[model samples]
Target: MKKFNLFKEIIITDRNVLTEAINSGKLFGIRVDGNICYEPFTLDDILIYRGTPDASLPIETIFGKNYQVLEDNDRVLIKAFSNWQEIIGFNSPRATYDDTTADGVDEFSTKEMENIGWHASEFNIKYRTLVDVLEDKCEGTLICIEQEEPYQFSGLGFIDDLADARDVLFEYCQREIQRLINEDEDYAQDNLNDDELEAAEFFKI
Candidate 1:
């Protein structure tokens, strides 16, 4: 049981990954008051929470505080990348333009460029799943979802990138499935009476 401090900012993009996380009984989303309010949130809820703008807040408030997650045991709080600012904080640029825009050529304002640079410098990339990392399609250091015992994505628990992580987890899952199948076969053989074993052997031909 590893621990992660949910108090830090966290990002999740794929809805399916989020859903699986919730169903896995490992993660939870809590409210500001320290109560688990978001545990029942669905994929649609997360999408809406991430997409809808909070009119009550100022425009500068990039990350919406609508929904949040908490580590199941430690009660560590987690926030979603609900806006462009939060996304950029993860080293992902908001947008890019070529030299040929309809209005001739567009350029990022000095302040915008500065913000981008700052985000890259302070980026704390984290991934919810191997698939989420794969979809990112970029190579960089990131943190694994395991919070209790933290490890660098590029070291120790060592993953080259999202693609590598995806392949490794997939292979692990396949091996586990096969292991379960073998266990079932062993249990059947152990429990079967003589007549059942004879019938099973006959079918084996």
Candidate 2:
């Protein structure tokens, strides 16, 4: 039983759109009263809410609100990188305890847990997911909508509903590129020997 309110609820007005989104295996979003309210995730997200009347709010009741709005969470850990190189660099994969987030540990395999020994299932680890980490890193809203293999994206959920995800990412990329360039230029200027710096300054137009 969910407490219902019309002004702030997620309901599907059309079943055809829902079916198309799920069946196409493509990203789909629902706009409620002119705002992007809900997006149907994989089958688990679709059916896991209840046997019937599983509206957007029900799913949100479980996993949407906290991660959707990261500020609500008491525990926020953000990791900083030196530059864009570090942000997009290769990362070595390892075992993770991603059960604490609203999405929980998704699609993690038993074989992947071999390192933890036979007591793995008996021992449950509740910790931060990448979305939690990225919110701290990017300092913006990040959305994850993929139903299958949620972790397949770069960060847990790199999404922006404000505009388009593509537009948002592009803008971020441009800003970071300029920031990195400026950082490198500043480092170069600071590291110059006094004589070189003086000479360079003198040569400046």
Candidate 3:
């Protein structure tokens, strides 16, 4: 049986924190559907399984602690499972880690951000280019952009040129991606699958 670690060592059993983690794109819950399911797990489904006797036994056995440690909070790191045997008792007959790789991480991040309502686009308008707009009015402006939906924009902003703006945006995107990845906790751990680890290592930011 393959070994998989789903989370970092920190044990988070708080319901509110778990919910916040899920909502803020920190922890991803696993959805069991026979053999195949999706990534960015569903919190409610995981919560349901966490309450079950069968799931509790395996979790306790694997973690060497009482199942109540989780407090019915379903949020966990992907690296939490040490092997397939540890997760076999889960609600799903087959628990697979298809999107735990670096590429998978990237795909998950992009889609997750979008699902949470982040809009990314090249600033374009009639006649004037994005560069023109930045150069004309945004130069020497201090601005802060919020990540959550109904984004609140504040301050004045400017860029040296279009290339600079593009780089800034790209850097911002990478930073957000890395931030999402870091939330997984196990992202930098040695316990990850070799392929997934390698993909993560090679992934830029």
Candidate 4:
């Protein structure tokens, strides 16, 4: 089964407000030991984690020592994106496996299997379903919430919480583009040629 690490602080006093904020994506937050502590007032999931002002001690110290302040009536939510994506091979329209022939009259040959069917496989359906989450509008807002120090908005799992499947696909394309660039400098430079680079801006969408 697929799973995700969801760290949420439950607010006993103002439960409704916190829940609403999570749904609407308007909650303010601060980092407490790699976990995001969200405000129970707003409804925006800003994905921002403001650490303690004191630079001497680590953020963890504040949470460890002054945890009572946070635990008063609210709960902290710390969920990792690792459990968001799952590859379930279901309703697979096509199946491709290695077919090897022993060397006898002819030399042994192995075939490379790929998407060799017309219909979507079970795994494909699963993937598609996951992709859909990042494209279509969702009942609740999907956010990339993190409690660690702020970092660039680009990179793997950047769109892991997107509510639109189409947007997820676009994000995937972007990820692939970046991955290719990093993995193959020559290919990236070649692809980045003047005109091609200009036209490639569509991928940013």
**Model 4, position 102: C-alpha lDDT score:** 28
- Return the TM-score for each candidate structure: 0.21, 0.21, 0.20, 0.20
What's the number of clashes in each of the models?
A: 9, 1, 14, 34
Q: For residues 48-70, write the lDDT of model 1, one tens digit per residue.
A: 12223333443224224544544
Residue 196 Cα positional deviation in candidate 2, in Å, after optimal superposition: 27
Mark the 10 consecutive residues where model 4 has the least summed lDDT.
86-95
RMSD (Å) of each candidate, 1 decimal: 22.4, 18.5, 20.3, 18.1
lDDT scores of the candidates, listed in order: 0.32, 0.29, 0.31, 0.30
In candidate 4, what are the lDDT values of residues 1-205, reduced to their tens digit?
1111122332122334434434454433432123345444132222323222343433234323323223323543333233212100110111111111121111101121012111112112233333243324323222222344552111111222223434444455555555655677654646566543542454551
